[model samples]
Target: MGIVSVSMPEDLLEEIDDIVETHDYSGRSELFREAGRKLVQEFREPSLEDRDLVAIVSALFPYDSPAVETKMTELRHTHASAVRSNSHSCICDDQGCVETFIIEGELATVSEFVRDVEATNEDVQVEYSLFPVDSIQRPTL
Candidate 1:
């Protein structure tokens, strides 16, 4: 292995230090190594022959942002077959809007759409999370 130097914000570095201490990590190096490995695995492309996966991608963005609203609508329409359903709600006056996309389709297609949604929202500096779903499907209401 080779040594690599990188920089991060002070707050993030402090959080990493806290995690290292709390989780009994050897140090920043070991923690970062493991993190890098996990990141690589999580981002690897899926193959056509692979089984389709059910996934849920939840994104929270400013409800008042026209661009974000349009992007989400277009995404749902473009992937209607893969997108099982979409549920949206507003948490409160100050919390913006939150939406979840239920997707059931080929692994590669789902992954690609998820990445696109994340990038679009991130361009607006929105926060989001994507997770694999179990066989259970929520009833459309």
Candidate 2:
């Protein structure tokens, strides 16, 4: 690896130091390296409009029921373009239960479908975000 020098603001440097201490990092070099990797990944990720995007739809539901699965399947079929993949998980809660889904599809359609699901299931809390692939710029070595 090539050595490089960087000048950071005093406050920012102090903040970095705090993070290092809190996380028990070996040194600022390690922290900076990880930060750089994330920055590069974010920069290299494609814009949503550039390609078909995958969306992860996470939801919390009041109980585990076949109705939830059926509804989710119907929602996926109705909005196929917005759903490339789907998955569900069960969470046990004192009041009832919670189910989560990770879905993939076109950004706009997926977002709309998520909204629809939320509207249909009043007791379910849904969250979703899109990640575009096939268009993300790969970093060069």
Q: Candidate 2's residue-wise lDDT over 1-141, tens digit each?
A: 977798756877899999999999999999999998985664355566446666677767655566766787788678765555666655554445444445555555555776778866555667666666785799999
The C-alpha RMSD of each candidate to the native structure, in angstroms, is 5.6, 12.8
What is the per-residue lDDT of model 1 for residues 1-141, given as tens digits with 9 covering 90 to 100?
A: 899997666877999999999999999999999998886676574432355667777788775877987888988998888898898778788468877888886667777777778777543333333444444479999
Q: Which residue segments of model 2 deviate by more than 4 Å?
A: 1-51, 93-104, 134-141
What number of clashing residue pairs does each candidate have, in the order they appear?
A: 0, 1
Off by more than 4 A, model 1? 1-33, 43-49, 123-141
The true-structure Cα RMSD of candidate 2 reads 12.8
Model 1: lowest-lDDT 10 consecutive positions: 122-131
User: Against the unseen true structure, what C-alpha lDDT does each candidate score?
Assistant: 0.75, 0.68
